[model samples]
Target: MLPASASQLLNPTDVGREFLRLLPIALFVIVFGIAFGLASVQAGLTDWQAILMSVTVFAGASQFATLELWGQHVSLLPLVAVVFAINARHILMGAALYPMLRELPAGRRYGILFLLTDANWAVASQDYQNGRQNLSVILGGGLVLWLAWVAGTVFGVTFGGLVANPEQYGLDMVLGCFLLSMVLGGKRSPRVLLIWTVAGLSAVAAYWWLPPHTHVIVGALAGGVLGYCWKERRHGG
Candidate 1:
């Protein structure tokens, strides 16, 4: 039998509320998306192509990274490798959520995974750790973010140069600040702190020594291994 949390239905009201809650962050997403659209155009993609990529891929960093590699004669293998390496963290993220996700119907499960991004995933995973089951944030917040990205792309392609310097507004730091806040909000035990320290050091080491875009996965795996080896003591164990 499925756990009670697994069978929990997503409330429409909760979804809408979460969407509104994330609206502020979505505005920042718009600015970054605009930048991406402008860059894509400069990289030789048509407006439609830029918008299509935003709609289909929905991954800002990877999209931007691809822009660096854009040329008349694109190398297919290199492109695929870069995309996979950059977004490989999604594999671990999905695996971390699989226990809860397995409770939903297969279609719903995969549908939710499609919407998973850093922000919504942070909220969902943090809430899950806090004993809350809130997949609505993943779905609703993701919808808002997706729409913001697509709309921003359209605006940039149609009226170019509107946002000349997104960095001036500190737009790039928004998501990082938000994710840090989520991590700080979680219950911090000595064990968890140690795990985080190991992850942080591992990431720094990988950033200096490993291939490009491998630090995140390396840090995550390091933390996972430590957690596995040193399980938290239960209340009565």
Candidate 2:
């Protein structure tokens, strides 16, 4: 009683390929998540609470941003808005699938979106556009990232602070470096670069001018809109 796509998610080749391809990034994400967990502890979160958030939310920057705002005594409404806004990128990422998955049933398309993340989106988007990817591949790879992030957070929360001179590992910059490298690679077009620059600047500005978390929402919306608009203009759609 499973759909074709759901059955595809269990394909061994897809899972194996993703497992091999993600090995390097897996370790990196783990270390990065650990750093976040450690940060959560120092920010006054209990050990179990930090790990739980990582497992349940599985969003690092958003989690950190929310915690930072909370530490400053920001109201819960704004905090929720900010995190939701930050997560809006997933919508844009899922939109990238329209061209590739237009023929799939609605439920399957939504299922894919539910598992998408910035990292998996980057990898799977490329594969999808290239006409070589399937639901199996995306799901296989996404599960890896999900597990890596969760394990990493738990590892860091449990033992990171105890490590003497954790700075020596330089794990703090993992996510930034990952995004920077990805953006630099994919920002090949002038329009893409313009949107990226605008979004980055807008987020920073929002941080300073708007209410708490507004910047995150604003940046995501601006970037997504710019990308969509640019694509429309270029494609005459």
Candidate 3:
């Protein structure tokens, strides 16, 4: 009951290409997740909680933020709001990736968007641009990130007591290092630096001016607006 064109569209080679492309990002995420798990556990999250969050949510930033907010004794509504706002970027991410997913089955597209994150988006974007929009690649990449996140969190929770001054030892700084290394190793672009700088400043400003998760929305909107405005102007729109 499958259309000939549809079957032809979903090529096996595309899956292989996606696998190759996601390998580096997968490694980075594994390492980063382990560090994050260690930080979270030392910060007071139990082993099961950290592991569960990793396996279920698989979002390191939101997970860390939740731990931070929980430590401050913030109420549930505010906590949820912050998590939602911080994750709002995924809406835009899903939109950007929608075109590629359209080439696949509806359920597949939905699943991909639901589980996709910054790291997965980066890999998928590259493949899409390269004309290798393979669904299998996306699945493989997402799985790697998910597993790394869970495994790292479990390891951290188990070994947290052994690590001393984790925050001071720069375990907390691994996210920055991971991102920085990714950029430095890639093409140097002024626009990229501009977006990053704007986003960082906005995050700081939001932290100062807004309530818990409000800053997350504000920072994201501020950075996104800055990036969009610049792109529009560049295109003479």
Clashing pairs in 2: none
* Model 2 per-residue lDDT tens digits across residues 167-233: 5877666656776665665426777768878898999999999866567568867887887777645
lDDT of 1 at 230: 90
Q: Of 1 and 2, which scores higher on lDDT?
A: 1
Using Cα atoms with residue i matched to residue i, what is each candidate's TM-score against the true structure? 0.95, 0.72, 0.68
How would you encode candidate 3's per-residue C-alpha lDDT over 1-237 as one tens digit per residue?
332343444456654565566666666565656667787776777777778788888777788787776674669997787678778877766776776667677876676555577666665565554555545655666766676677766766766445434566666665566555544554446876687688778878878876655554566667678877776445476
Q: Go through the candidates in order and give each one's C-alpha lDDT.
A: 0.89, 0.70, 0.66
Clashes in each model (backbone N, CA, C under 3 Å)? 0, 0, 0
Which scores higher on TM-score, 2 or 3? 2
Error of 1 at 208 (Å): 0.9
In Å, residue 77's CA in model 3 sits off its true spot by 0.6
Off by over 4 Å in 3: 1-17, 39-44, 71-74, 127-137, 161-237
What ranking emerges by TM-score with the best candidate at the front? Answer: 1, 2, 3
* Deviation of model 1 at 12, angstroms: 1.6
